[model samples]
Target: MRQLLSYGLFGVIFFHLFFPHNISAQSVDTVYFSLDMTEPISEGWLKHGTEIVGIRGDQSPLNWGNTFEASDPDKDGIYEVAVPFNLHSDSLLVSFKIKVDGVNNPDDGWQKGRNHEAMIYQGVKNKVTLKWADEPPQAPTTITGQVEIFRDFQSDNLVPRDLYVYLPPGYKESNQRYPVLYMHDGQALFDASEIGQEWRVDEAAEELIRAGEIEPVIIVGIGNTQNRFDEYTPTEQVWRYELNRISSQERTTFPEAFAGNYISTEGDTIRFKTKHDTLLTMIPGGQFWQPLIPESEHAFFLAQAGITFTFDVKETEVNQVVASKPTMGGDGDLYGGFIIKKVKPFIDQNFRTRPEREFTSLGGSSLGGLITLYLGLEYQDTFSNLLVVSPSVWWDGQMIISKVNELPGATNQHIWLDMGTAEGEGAVESAKALNKALLNKGWSKENLNFVIEEGAAHNERAWAKRVPDMLRFLYSKN
Candidate 1:
């Protein structure tokens, strides 16, 4: 037996004679992603460990002229890297570090960053089959955050959104249906290691539930999609043409070649942001935005230039309705009927969710919050509890408040309205204006709860911090 073991080891080493010596140490660790985001290259990226990974495979040697590269699905003419997944770990904080012209990690506030973005992939591999590692990147426990991947699987490739759901310590043990809090930007909910970015929603939910301040409510933290600018934008398709132009550049720069990649780098950096091509094109009863990029590789595209241009296009949707329904405008009552109906029923049946007419609740921020308000008012019977976190009451000519005022306040419904003192230029004021309207409509101070996060901003963290408070208000019995 000992001699056979020795022979097996020797055979493995001999077989590797044709392979690269520097291939990631399969016995010790795994390489998750490689990234570069600089130059005229407009390669897109995914968020992994707060860093960016290049999904663009064709962009490589990212130097000035050809610095523009494609990402994950590397066929876009950018350099690419194929991250290895055959190895296993408990979990990992795996991602890439992009440095250009001698830039280093966490530069002082002085240096202009040359580090193009990359993708970030945290947590364990799919289905949780682990290997023999003394210390793996993720643990099997909720405290150690085995619950990651806040993606939406409504359809195969249509709208590949991310989501976050906090499974308490005893989640697997009980079948009791818990109250669910669906949050936007689901990707950033848990994982404080994500720096001051993304809301630490999971951590906060866990702590609050454990502390008994907030009941044990299930938090559904969903990450936004590239089409987020279109979907989340109040004006459904208003920003359509602009996005088309942006897509043209992105497609040209980060074309999705669903194959492997050709990448090279300095100081041993690799571009491993290649994408997978395995997706169900025709999913049952779901919407499809773009084709599903498979879980093929972990690579990156380093766009060296055109940052301002992309921002101009993507950011324009931030404070404005980027697009609306194809035939129906942002205020269209005719569009998205199929998707909304399907999603609501799916959530109700798939999970142990409370009925929308009674204990059910919904909330979001800015445009997201606006949606909940509109939905709740429109379908008052479906959702009885209302939690609008800094709703964009200013949009659509501020018509929602007038609509709410026209109707008599219902004692059966509970409304929790809040805003960050520093949400935006006029966020607090806007919230106050809506609060006043609600008050005039006969909502009492006790029933209509309002709050302001002292130092919180308009991000996931702010929402997470207030989630506990919001939950308490929503489920409170007056």
Candidate 2:
């Protein structure tokens, strides 16, 4: 006998009935996925060769770790797959992406952008059409007003990069000067971006200006280069500490005064003798060690155990350690100099801009955000507003917070600082600590706007959502 179990609108299950024996159940709810291979196939980006099309998602039988193959039964350009999901409730929300020739690797053929999400109702067969990452749907031209792109703008302090200048509406008609907000990562600020998603800054700015929600302003987007890490970071990052220690069995006693021995390297191994008389050896595998700060030649950082060591290498052994240390950062000052001396002059001369400090602002996110804070503090007289979004406060051990604490008094700049709860606890906590530091440094509540957006992730999508708020706070008519 066949028995049916109905869960109202939630779902339906079928069970094979046996005489007081075991039974098997099956779910009726299924999701159908279809993929269009015309574009990728025609463009030569994908060949309809033996490569299998599949779907990968967060649901059971559809995890990101592996792909569930789809079939082109009729040899048509369209490939389809029916996925059955066991439903416990009325509905299920699934997030997924399309993959081609994907085995156990998540990124083998994964599509970009934010993951596609769908709400699946029990007892319902939902159909979805997806395109490949090679052929992402073109985003509509959401840019409003005028944008001027300067390709390979030369800089004396840093490498040349493109610059995107966004002019507000009526700027061409009127002769009034507008305040300028300089942002980093120019490529990700517009509709077309190197990253899959864009921040849509132009759209947000245009909408807010039209609604009179914020004062009309000009925005400058500074393009980044391959040296983004060096240009954005204020100090060199310690990849990891290398310690060469003799085993307890191989211990050789030494005087307590000799505990402060200098680090010396022989060939590939770094040798140092500790007070315990144990020969410490560190095999140079990663980047060489450098002082975290500019003023110090040798810096002290904790490694395994409670032992402390000063990283001081002689000038002759610098080349030996060079092989051990990764490329050191601390080029942020030069980056700031480039913006101030090159980009700012060009903008001020070419455009009708309010060049005063009160009308100037800087904004960025992640490492870009970190550099923005560094620039805002370093050039307090040059910028009056700052939009620091999801800054990497963990950079160089929260050096930004210490920079704020060292400030004698807070300047009159308006600052917008924010972090998403989903960005991770370390990031959220770092933002909170920076907030408290700013508050203690005499920044008033009206001047510093700190927001912790719940359920927000650290990506362009989240930043795009907060752009309007950032503009409102930084350029409010009030």
Candidate 3:
């Protein structure tokens, strides 16, 4: 079984009632969208005759998969479109983004950040005006504390990237050493995120420290690169195959009966053999026997031969079948080594840090969260506190759970594991399973905190909302 579970019953009901597929015309409200393309037009990025502007969103008449065209009938730089919504209640929220030169052209434009949100209500203008799509939102003046950047910090184990350090208040005058909290995705941690949305960690930390709700800590934001997926995942995914039910005679074609196994690499091709000596072979990206061959390196469509193959890979070897396509990962150990061997030493040397395991914490969300847990397990002496938020436990067939099972016993660490009720049932279930695994491995409830946030989505905004709570849980003065 996949071993994943959680869904918000209220969110489900709300979705069904307000955003159903078959919304009646009487309940529909039209929302007007206007995009100012002055910059793109002036920069020659969008040639009037060669390209056009459109909208993509998560609502009717607009979806992320397709583009809806907007027009500039008055020959002005502002393009406009009106989309209808089924607004039975007093208000509805719609998320959308602007795309220039259609969906096929990636170079010209794709709005950054979390999708732009707008609220729709009865007897309202419901107009949304976007100045630009390809730029970061203006930094809010309300940003608290100070941020220092180490431009393109070099690392032997990973690519060079900038490191943003958030210094707590009163660091210069007071010679006090503080605990350090290392977080991944440096770009999204503050107001200057490449994507318009940010976690506002600096603001949250400043607030908590001022209120004396949590201990003041230095936050190190490690920037991510193109190798993010590989760096964040602890193991490489390898393909698994399972036997499909077929005629007895066809089953005899293979030597001995077997459930499934990982596809092994032969001289030049990948092969899977049965215990009784039946063999299946094919070069990746090449054709094999008409109906029994793999179509590509990532897919095998052999339904006719009483055998089924999945492109999805598991971190650990498994005998069951899966349906997801294969993706690159497995560089997490190297990434962790980069931080441990290179990043941390530099931070400790330059910053006024406590430089102790108990004072050092590691955290991130989604895949970053996955790597945090992996590193926490592997390097207990380095990081004694972990903030794992909405971790992708489903990665590599929930291999992290298996890793938890393999541990001799839990160490003395303060661990926080959380998942939103709206982040999908599988994610919630995986978190629940991980929580159970930790308990089974002897982690006391007092040391581990598991939270399921209601109506929270998997994004920077949602993660931002939990920052105060996470900090308090990890560094509460009381």
Best by lDDT: 3
Model 1: per-residue lDDT, tens digit, 13-59?
Answer: 11121121233334333233333333213333222222222221111
Error of 2 at 144 (Å): 2.4
C-alpha displacement of 270 in model 3, angstroms? 23
Shift in Å, residue 277, candidate 2: 31
Query: What does candidate 3's lDDT look like per residue over 47-107, in tens digits?
Result: 5533446777655546543455677877678899888766657876666788764223444
* Predictions: Cα RMSD each: 20.1, 16.4, 11.8
lDDT of 1: 0.43
lDDT, model 1, position 200: 57
Instruction: Show pairs that collide, candidate 3.
Output: 5-425, 5-429, 6-425, 256-276
Candidate 2: tens digits of C-alpha lDDT, residues 303-363: 2111234443443222112212334578999999999998999999999999999999999
Tell me the whole-model lDDT of each prediction, alpha carbons only.
Answer: 0.43, 0.68, 0.70
Leading candidate by TM-score: 3
TM-score of each: 0.48, 0.60, 0.65
Higher-lDDT candidate of 1 and 3: 3
Residue runs of model 1 more than 4 Å from their true location after superposition: 1-38, 41-152, 155-158, 192-196, 233-340, 408-411, 476-478
